[model samples]
Target: MNELQNTLRRLLRVVIGGRWGVFAWSLSGASALAVILWGLKAVAIPLLMIKTASWGIWGLGVIRESKLRTPIRP
Candidate 1:
């Protein structure tokens, strides 16, 4: 029972981690924007552009974090 509780706590912590929040928000926002754009027009070019830009921003953030060598907090 103790081991099961410990494992459950660990999994909960991982699911609720700080980085997960950031990543989830970024992904959700991008998806929402794409959906909005698609509803406005059938063409997918604008949505693609938005997706690329979003990913580019994410990449830049990763690069900056890597260069700073900051330890990611849970």
Candidate 2:
């Protein structure tokens, strides 16, 4: 698992550490993930929605805290 993670990191570094790299990689990864999710229909849809909403809520909470001048806690 560590080896696979290392290999992916290297591959992504090479792919994303080039000209206009961030945008290119973001698009490539998002498209590939979309295709995989599309293939996994039923399960992926709910999971994606759940994950997105969780992130959205967490993000809004962070912004709210920031606006309220609250210190972030661990």
Candidate 3:
């Protein structure tokens, strides 16, 4: 469980670390959104899993940081 939390925190940091990170996240988010909106059902389902995981990492990291009074540096 601790490893999972640490891994997620690291991933969240990478997501907001720099312009490259922002661009990568944006592309993934857009691609996931597009797939959910109009892509084939088969492909969209798998992409949805990935998208949910990404969002979950971000959400959990924020919540954990807040509870621990740790700064989430942008």
Candidate 4:
């Protein structure tokens, strides 16, 4: 019982902490879909642009971190 309680507590904490990122990603996808489906090309384009820019920034960060983690070949 004690072990089960500890496991549940950790799971709850992880879920709570990750909720915001999950929500934001879901909202971004949903909004983009809404714009596209509703024939709001003008609005959709800008929203997609923003999404792409964010992905680019995220990719850059990942790349930088990966490089830092790797040993230099020189």
Candidate 5:
């Protein structure tokens, strides 16, 4: 089991360190996520809406905090 684990780790290091490996891995993950989201039609819609709203609220909070921290000039 330990030898198998070490071999897997070595393979991963080689794959990730090789040129184009990062892009390939990123693309693979994104494609998998896209397929999963497509399959979850009902859940994805509401989840996306909530995620977008949260981002907007977070942005507004950041803007308000920055304004409050800055001193008003004459």
Candidate 6:
């Protein structure tokens, strides 16, 4: 029972983390601007550009995490 509870907690944390990562990368200020611009038809922004920005955000987060002295654990 304890092991199952631990596994469930880990799974929940991972799911929540993934959602936050997606939101942070894809729904960030720059990404949001790109989306708005695309919506307004002012610029023909490529989907790749948005995806690249999201990857860049993820990369930055990874670098920042590596710089931390202690890794965060749930």
lDDT of 5 by residue, 1-74 (tens): 99789767655545353333444445445545765877666457655655565445445545554444454789
TM-score of 5: 0.41
Question: Candidate 5: lDDT over CA atoms?
Answer: 0.54
Q: Candidate 2, clashing residue pairs? A: none
Residue range 1-74, candidate 1, lDDT tens digits: 99789767655444433353356447758677767867746636766676677566555655554444444589
Q: Lowest summed lDDT over 10 consecutive residues: which window, candidate 4?
A: 13-22
Q: Pick the candidate with the highest lDDT.
A: 3
Model 1 worst lDDT window (10 residues): 12-21
Q: Report the lDDT tens digits of candidate 2 across residue range 1-74.
A: 99789767655544444333444445446645766866655456765665565445445544543444433599
Arrange candidates by TM-score, descending.
1, 5, 4, 6, 3, 2
lDDT of 3 by residue, 1-74 (tens): 99889878765665463343454467568767777787767576777676676566555655554545454699
Give the distance in Å from residue 68's predicted Cα in candidate 3 to where it truly belongs: 2.7
Least accurate 10 contiguous residues by lDDT in model 5: 15-24
- Cα displacement (angstroms), candidate 4, residue 32, comes to 7.6
Better of 4 and 6 by lDDT: 4
Runs in model 3 with CA error above 4 Å?
1-42, 70-74
On TM-score, the stronger of 2 and 5 is 5
Scored by Cα lDDT, where does model 2 land? 0.53
Runs in model 1 deviating more than 4 A are 1-43, 70-74
Summed over model 1, clashes come to 0
What's the lDDT for residue 74 in model 1?
Answer: 100
Show model 4 residue runs off by greater than 4 Å: 1-42, 71-74
Q: Which of candidates 2 and 4 reaches a greater TM-score? A: 4
What would the TM-scores of all predictions be?
0.44, 0.36, 0.37, 0.39, 0.41, 0.37
